[model samples]
Target chain A: NAGVTQTPKFQVLKTGQSMTLQCAQDMNHEYMSWYRQDPGMGLRLIHYSVGAGITDQGEVPNGYNVSRLNKREFSLRLESAAPSQTSVYFCASSAGGTGVSYEQYFGPGTRLTVT
Target chain B: LAKTTQPISMDSYEGQEVNITCSHNNIATNDYITWYQQFPSQGPRFIIQGYKTKVTNEVASLFIPADRKSSTLSLPRVSLSDTAVYYCLVGPDYGGATNKLIFGTGTLLAVQP
Candidate 1:
């Protein structure tokens, strides 16, 4: 299986620009999450979905939005990208939700730069 | 979410055992300690997790004290490929949000071959 995959491996955006980063998992996992890694910082949760049609805000959800249209996809949208928004974006999936026992599988990560 | 404190960095030699300790003094009684390993350009991967006592897997071993306030991730043999940042997370092991993990500043383990 392909596990979790994210699109747009690299992107360079100008301030005020908008873009959507796509994520998908073949594992049929019921949980998906988005996180951003800043320099010298730990990953911060952006948004998450427990299943298709169920979404929730996470620790750092101010600059982003997410939707779970189908079970296999969880896309992150950055509206009005700012220089502070530049960071590595990662998509992860887990086997279950509500204290699921399995480990989280992550994507390679998308390198984003807002100049 | 309980806060976790781990060494910002560590250095290890090849073939040596590396144990990275993490402290979570305020860990909730039901919280579980989970460890994740992240490469320079990748997402964090789950290494091991435990609530109490020790849990061993092929990748690493997680040692949690009876009080559940601390945990140690033991890497049996160090190698160049093992050099990466390790994250310690604390949360309910079951019956909580599946992916609401609080990843704090993790320990950067540098293994020199």
Candidate 2:
């Protein structure tokens, strides 16, 4: 099903530069999320969307913004990159329902380095 | 969100059984314990999950005691490929329309030949 896929597997940016990481899922999931993983740390949520056109902030939302324009696409944008943002970014999607718990499918992840 | 505590690293030999335990003393009644496995340079993958007692899947088994304050992930006959970071997560069992998962530092399991 191709599950979930992320774009720009690797990126390097100068401080204050802006970029966007793209995520797409073919599973027809209602929920999508963005997370960042630093060295020797667990993945932390950056932002999430309940559905198309409904976005919300997550645990680590600062310096990051997200938009879910359609059901299959969720994009994360960094307005101004900082050194702290240098980490691996992952995208996940889940089929949310009334009685179902969250079972997420993650993408390969994008490695970003902000100098 | 309930916080999870696990060992930073564990080492075992191939063909041996490895059991990694996690503690979530503050886990709420509605929260479920889930485990994820992640290889280097890859995203985390769901392994097993349970609320209480025992749950077994093809990949691994999740054992939760009566109190549910702690849980263990048992890997049978481990192999080098099974060496990875294991994350224990606690989240609402039925969050309904707004379910989100939080992850903590996972235990790194190294399987040697």
Candidate 3:
């Protein structure tokens, strides 16, 4: 059902360039999250949204911004991309906003490389 | 959030059962242990979750000890496609406060051909 979809599966940007990574879920989940995976670092959260119009900062929100305009979309934007921003970005959604044991469903991922 | 610790890697032959354990000594009373599997370049997918005892799904089984301090994910009759990184997560998950999963170096499972 294309549970979660991310746009621009791969991208390359020069330093100071700006770009947006889009995420959407057809599962109608209440919570959505953004994370970046770097070599040996595992995955770190970038930002999240509890519901439409409700957004919050995650462990690694620097150099990035997020918006939750509607129930189906949560997008991540890099204002001015840096070399450190190069990594594989993922988006996730969960029905767990209401329960204690909610499990997250993830998007395929967006691999971004900044030179 | 309770911090989690797991192995760096594991290896097993096809048709064998593989058990990967994770330790979360600081786990709170309300925290739950969850597991996810990830192939390279893909997002981690949820495998199973449990508060205590054992919970089994079609893909894997999760066993949480009585003390709630650790948990194990057991894959039965694993095949080549089962080779991936496994992550164990422990958190309160109250009001989405624990939404960000802080991943350690996940166990890289390599199933022999």
True contacts kept of 2: 0.49
From the highest DockQ down, the ranking of the candidates is 1, 3, 2
Q: Higher TM-score: candidate 2 or 3?
A: 2
Q: Roughly what TM-score does model 1 have, to 2 decimal places?
A: 0.95
Judging by lDDT, tell me the better candidate of 1 and 2.
2
Give stretches of model 1 more than 4 Å off.
A98-102, B96-99
> Tens-digit lDDT track for model 3 on A11-108?
99999999999999999899999989998778888888889999988888889999999999999999999999999999989876522367788899
Off by over 4 Å in 2: A97-100, B96-99
Residue pairs with colliding backbones in model 2 are none
Candidate 3 structure quality by residue, lDDT tens digits, B1-113: 78888999999999999999999999998888888899987898888888899999999999988898889999999999999999898877576645457778889999998
Q: What is candidate 2's DockQ?
A: 0.53
Q: How many residue pairs clash in each candidate?
A: 1, 0, 0
Q: After superposition, how far is residue A16 of candidate 1 from its true place, in Å?
A: 1.2
**Model 2: residue A47 alpha-carbon error in angstroms:** 0.4
Q: Write the per-residue lDDT of candidate 1 for residues B2-100, one digit (tens) a residue.
A: 888999999999999999999989988778788889988888888887879999999999988888788889999888999999999888767436437
* Cα lDDT, all candidates: 0.88, 0.90, 0.88
Error of 1 at B17 (Å): 0.6
Q: Candidate 2 lDDT, tens digit per residue, A4-95?
A: 99999999999999999999999999888899999999988888888999988888999999999999999999999999999999999888
Candidate 3 chain A: worst 10 consecutive residues by lDDT?
A95-104
Q: Candidates' DockQ values?
A: 0.59, 0.53, 0.55
